[model samples]
Target: MTVADGTARLCAPAPGGGDLGLWQRVIDALRTADQWGSSDSTGTPEIWAHITEGQR
Candidate 1:
């Protein structure tokens, strides 16, 4: 997700279309300092990437 100028752009599709809920959850996770580095530890959000961010 791209958090810029106060807006978080999650999963961009060709540029604009993306999941708003996912972005919100990502923001929440980051804001809460929750475990967000791995799928196994990120809880039920099921949104963590298994690979490096650059790889994704």
Candidate 2:
């Protein structure tokens, strides 16, 4: 996924690592954005929790 301010990044599926790294980076960036930054790290945890816990 691409972020604003004309600064976009990439994440590739590394061999043997599955799809965790890219997902983490995207979530981390989301946690960094001033416009959408989370008050706590709980945001990523919550979202991932939903996906992981089958709540979504």
Candidate 3:
């Protein structure tokens, strides 16, 4: 999945939504947090990399 500008773009699943979906969900959350930015900085949602289970 790809998260950009606070919007989430999910990839088509192979069959049943598997680990990729789960990983995507986690990544989306992190991306959201990152988009929120640090309290000291202005909040501007930016494009972030896809997060996988291993990276967690």
Candidate 4:
């Protein structure tokens, strides 16, 4: 994904954990984003919420 400023965001599989692993990868990517500097501390639950929103 590319932000308005042209920064490209990406997600990649980590090798073993499948969807659960992808969550971590996505969180790591989000944490590194300039727009989301503290994603580790703040964005995890939000991310998981979005990810699992319709599964229930």
Q: Which runs in model 2 stand beyond 4 Å of their true positions? A: 1-18, 35-56
Q: What TM-score, over all chains together, does every model reach? A: 0.28, 0.29, 0.28, 0.31
lDDT of 1 at 35: 31
Candidate 4 per-residue lDDT, tens place, 1-56, comes to 33334344433322334578776776676654444422245434233112222232
RMSD values, in order shown: 13.0, 13.7, 12.5, 12.5
Model 3 agreement with the true structure over 1-56: per-residue lDDT tens digits? 67565554443322233678866765566574423222212344233333343333
The segments of candidate 3 whose C-alpha lies over 4 angstroms from its true place after superposition are 1-18, 35-56
TM match of model 1 to true structure: 0.28
Clashes of 1: 0
In the predicted model 2, the residue pairs found to clash are none
Q: Tens-digit lDDT track for model 1 on 1-56?
A: 66655444333222124778766766565454323343324333334322233422
Lowest summed lDDT across 10 adjacent residues in model 1 is found at 47-56
**What local lDDT does model 3 show for residue 2?**
74
TM-score of candidate 3 on Cα atoms, chains taken together: 0.28
lDDT of 1 at 53: 30
Tell me which of candidates 1 and 2 scores higher on lDDT: 1
